[model samples]
Target: MEQRVDRVEQRQDRLEDIVATMGELLIETREMVVEMRRENRQTRRIWIAIARKQELFDDDEFQDVFGDE
Candidate 1:
């Protein structure tokens, strides 16, 4: 019975460690996602500016709106 209890405690400790590692990974993944979104926004802005310059999008209203991005 004592050995069984010890084994249970060891398993519980290992489970706790795994949970903590998963939490850290979740936080890192969230940070990476945020960074990627920011990069995508910047890339979109550059593309729009290029298109405007090339006159592919020749609406003054669109120019006014995307100019702020």
Candidate 2:
């Protein structure tokens, strides 16, 4: 009976350790997702800037009507 209790206690301790590790991993995953969202936002801003500049290039009347302005 004592040996059985000891085995159960050891298993409970190991389970607690696994739970702690899973919690840490969850926190890390959340942080990584937040960082990726931030990077995606920055990338979208750059794309918008590029598209605006492209519109200017596509507008030939922009130069003919407002030359060197």
Candidate 3:
């Protein structure tokens, strides 16, 4: 019947909408994970730089900042 066809079409439309929203969410999550990884790498580089400079500082200030390096 025509009514049954209409119902099926509506259901399909709703499913398509859900799929689109899920796809958008997946893309956003991937971007956020990538950004976090980049930030972590940058932080590691900064720590390495600080450690390399440790010999320049006197014992007390270095210990205060870097905790008994």
Candidate 4:
């Protein structure tokens, strides 16, 4: 009976550790996704600015392609 209780307690402790680790991973994954989205937005803005500077499209055409900034 004592051995069974010890085994159960050990398992409970291990499960707690695994849950904590998973929570940390979930938070880290969310942060990474946020950072990636921010970087993508910045990259898109830079490309649009370059295209406009190079006059890749006329005003109306640019509007049609990219919409209003």
lDDT string for model 4 (1-69, tens) is: 999999999999999999999999999999999999999999989988999899999999889878887
In model 1, what lDDT does residue 25 have?
100
| lDDT digits (tens) for residues 1-69 of candidate 3 | 999999999999999999999999999999999999999989866885676676656677666765743
lDDT of 1: 0.88
Considering every candidate listed, which one attains the maximal TM-score? 1
Q: Which lDDT tens digits does candidate 2 get at residues 1-69?
A: 999999999999999999999999999999999999999989866765675577755456655644444
| TM-score quality measure for candidate 3 | 0.68
- Candidate 2 versus truth, CA RMSD in Å, comes to 8.6
The list of candidate 1 runs beyond 4 A from truth reads 60-69
User: For model 1, what is the error of residue 66's alpha carbon versus the real structure, in angstroms, after optimal superposition?
Assistant: 7.3
Q: Best lDDT goes to which candidate? A: 4
Candidate 2 residue 66 Cα shift, in angstroms, is 28
Order the candidates by TM-score, highest first.
Answer: 1, 4, 2, 3
lDDT digits (tens) for residues 1-69 of candidate 1:
999999999999999999999999999999999999999999998888788788775577676767655
lDDT of 2: 0.80
Candidate 3 Cα lDDT to native: 0.83
* Worst 10 contiguous positions by lDDT, candidate 4: 60-69
